[model samples]
Target: MFQSFTPLNDKVRLCQGCDLPIRVQQELPYGKNAYCPRCGTQLSRGGSPSLSGNLALAITCLLLFIPAFIFPFISIHLLGVTFSATVPEGAWNLMSHGFPLLSLLVLFCSVIAPIVLCAALVVCHLALHKHWFTGMKLGTTIIYRLKPWAMIDVFLVSVAVACFKLKDYSDIIVGPALYALIVLQLLSVLLISRVSLRRYWEAWRPEHTFEHQSKERHCIYCHLSQPVGTHCQRCHQPLHHRKPRSLERTLAYLLAASLAIFPANLIPISILITNGQRLEDTIYSGVISLFNSQMPGIAIIIFVASILVPMAKILGLGYLLVCAHWRKERFQRQRMKIYFVVKVIGKWSMLDLFVISIMLTLVDRGQILDFVPGIGAIAFGLVVFLTLLATESLDSRLLWDNHPNSPTSGRSINER
Candidate 1:
């Protein structure tokens, strides 16, 4: 039900989602947005092209990042003993407990990625604003590459889930770091949403109208239109009609995720030793335990984020690959929608991993109460990371390439 816009001039953009060319005005009116008429990928959002606002927000986040990780995030009290946990402490504890992969995953997603994003933004915007061309491209590229991995908001949600799971057995104390983290999460979200590689590129150099040609490539990284078989003039990445070896790479990641997911769900993800008794919980059993503890809502949240989201990504990506490989043109729009959902939800699957990290820090009171990450946590974390890679590697544009009615087929797909 999308309305098509007529191409008014030679100013064209390739929709990253659907791989169709969209003719658009060079700049949109303030506060308006443009979407792909065929598949609904946002092509442009209206706003000032200024870099100062983004620079300010990025600097603020960098300033706040210290206290958010250094101070105690939360305190747990059980049986007259109080223990506090910080973000860095949780990661270090996981590493010390021999789950180095899990610890690094938590540290990167919660600490390192956000810091990189903020630091990159600060450098990129400052370079662009001051006309320092030396590091602008590299800085901007890093920002886009690392933005999806920055999960401050998701980590905050995991914090709440961890508290919910522990409240029944322990008194929880919210700490100053938690408040700072909340603000950091909010600012991070705002800064990430406002950033666009396309806009930044345009700010650095205004878009130029290029002649339409039979062999043209649109740079996915910087959204530049250039000749096929040449590197993008803006970002300098090699251009391709479609992602080279897109199907093969997608299938590989999906197959690996498929193999890892079974052990992830069936094996114990967490272990609790309390009162001289040992208890291990698989993903399924953990959800059941939450339900039995009368926290059905948190159970459902964990179920969807941990169990269902991974399955959906694998199944959904597998189906899309099959269709795209066979040139099955039916339901291309629906498939695009599925791709978007899979991409967006892939990060949430790490919620369980983050929760495990938090629990490891909160409940290590020696023999009285202790939590350990089980073998399944590593597999689950791998599954999440692999699925994220699969989603990123799969080029959605490939689905439209072989369709006879698509724009690539010499038919104007946007025409009514």
Candidate 2:
């Protein structure tokens, strides 16, 4: 039922390494790699079902999406009076306090984004099941479009920070809903990974069936038939072989984030004083006080999320860039592990921001022990924001794309 298509200048190419004539076979399966028999250089194939897994992930995300929205994310207790707020409640509280901008941000990140992402996933999955490829394509497109909105990781970190900030003023209790929200966020991430579009598309396209008969030349490294001796643009070497920049870009971002972390921690996220005259502290000071107050467990968490995690991310990304540039192949595998950790943990830096928002919304003492955002909070927020951008901007494929034997010049052959 398929038609044979041919390139205008089809030709048989000789492998530079092996000097063997190369044949262009018609209809290679999508994502399958081939190589020269003599030198074992790679070849490229494309086309796969892009929407199937993403559709399933979207559906599952919808199931978890409900509890995340309805549950109370946190509870606050002050002066023996307890108050609770869900994601929406927190936003409203921010708005009521004349911090409309903060409220809107809270609403968007904590509530709206997660919900929309779940909905988009469900739509994409359903389209794929019906064999509506166009619909599936649109769904995948929407999924990418909505990915930035799923900020549950950010929200969760914020919740942790908020809990730390509230410890001194009165008894703080983490609500059931807050735990549920965390679970939902995790599930959402899992769903996104499961439905990776690239994997699916590589499997769905039709295979080619015809073979080219003209004389041609193929790269010695990657076995693609080139017009003659041409270099792979991605690897920037002579056409004979393939393999694979900027430490400066990574370092620039790391330095920027590091500079921002100072203000983020110094900013007065919230102040608590026993009976209005005992103590005042920002997030950093509060963590110290927590340790001093014999609460080492909470102190450790604060130290990790607020201090260690962010620094590790910056340092880790920097290291990955440096190592990759230097071609330190011994620890090459370690780079992948580090990249995964950085991507996963970068959002947690926003925990401080979440805590500040929650504290400002939950605690109000009419100037007795007021909660006002410090300049450091804004700086810290910028640091987290920029760092997340930096992490995303980094191309993880760089870690694996440089193998001398990789096909398509190490450009991802799969288009899913």
Candidate 3:
């Protein structure tokens, strides 16, 4: 059941690339892209979206997620002993082993968030072009907000990497859940992204057009349109054209993460105890060990996730902040592109942390191969968390404010 929200007099949009607010002109034909006149960013490509297709993918993803939870993901056999754990089982094991925080983190990233995200999309797509369910707007808003927190793909990669790491000393078997998890990744992506911008605009139902001076507002959280100072009629969140305290909060987070990266890199992330021989591994030593172990691919993955990503993110955000503060209108589009890349990869940088968590949970059996968490683990995790907050705190709208034509660009984008 779906229902429409309050009617509007203007179709206000915040550019995904530049955040410049403007009215949608006549709907373009399917497959044609409309670029922003101010920043040359492709605003939207016209198309008739298949709500049915999205619904099918969401349903399929839900089916697969069930098996991904039930089937044992990995079996490691050593001597005469065999141990296996499913996704939720692993989280429970982590909790039973006294790491409740990591357990909750694993459960949310792999299970709860993915399920809610897919379920939300199904509801939103079913409610498309008309609202019948009071939860449509709330559900859709949750999908957008939860997408980043769903780490099924990253968790799958971690599981695969864990199996490979265990293969040297133990018999390794990938279970049915891993396969289901893989396919779920593909379909779940469609569930998350298949809904077109055109469908969102149409379903939300703003007025067909309006004067450039109408002073409309767009919700940053839900992307719903409203007039200035009014609550978002759809999602009920207070309206802010851009994130509040955007630049100041972003800079604060950037500085804090910068302080953290040094110790996070310099200290051991986890300690290894094999047959009672103790070894400490800094992040660099771990990557070096992976290379020495002839697992260059895994080593490269760890290096990128642990070393390169954080450094790049720190530098990238600092550069974007400096450019914004300096009002260097040059390369506005390029800056926006950089911002997007940094934001997307911020979560993936947690791959090392996930790997450590998995090993800590699974390998604590009588020192055959035991892994224990280290102090630097906290520092490293903070770096990842802070960078994520920094990215969210940034307001892309600031990028266009200094442009020479930005003042008149809203009206100009209407024609383009």
- TM-score winner among the candidates? 1
| lDDT of candidate 2 over 1-416, digit per residue (tens) | 01112343343444333334444454457665556453343333334434545556566666666665676567776766776666676677657756566566667767776777767666655664576666555555566555655688767766765676566666777677766776777777777545544333323332121234332333322234433345532222355322212345666777898787776677665445445574556667878877887878767777777788888988888787777566564554567668768877766665665666677666664634456555555566567666776776565434433434423321222222
Clashes of each: 0, 30, 7
The whole-model lDDT of each prediction reads 0.83, 0.58, 0.72
Which stretches of candidate 1 lie above 4 Å from their native place?
Answer: 1-9, 209-215, 405-416
Global fold similarity of model 2 (TM-score) = 0.64
Question: lDDT tens digits, residues 1-416, model 1?
Answer: 11223344255566777656666655676777777777777877775656677788899999898899999999999888888999888789989999888889889988999999889887887778688876687788788788879998889999999999888779999999999999998888988888888878777776674444432567887787655666777677777878889999999999999999999999999998877889999999999999999999999999999999999999999999999889886888889899889988989998999899899999984748888999999999999989988998898888877655443422322321
- Judge candidate 1 at residue 1 and give its lDDT: 11
lDDT of 3 at 378: 71
Summarize candidate 3's per-residue lDDT along 140-208 as a digit string, tens digits.
677767777888778878877776667786788677877898898877776665655336535656434
lDDT of candidate 1 at residue 371, scale 0 to 100: 87
Tell me the TM-score of each prediction against the true structure. Answer: 0.93, 0.64, 0.86
Q: Which stretches of candidate 2 lie over 4 Å from their true place?
A: 1-67, 77-82, 91-108, 129-134, 142-168, 171-190, 199-252, 266-269, 278-283, 323-330, 365-369, 399-416
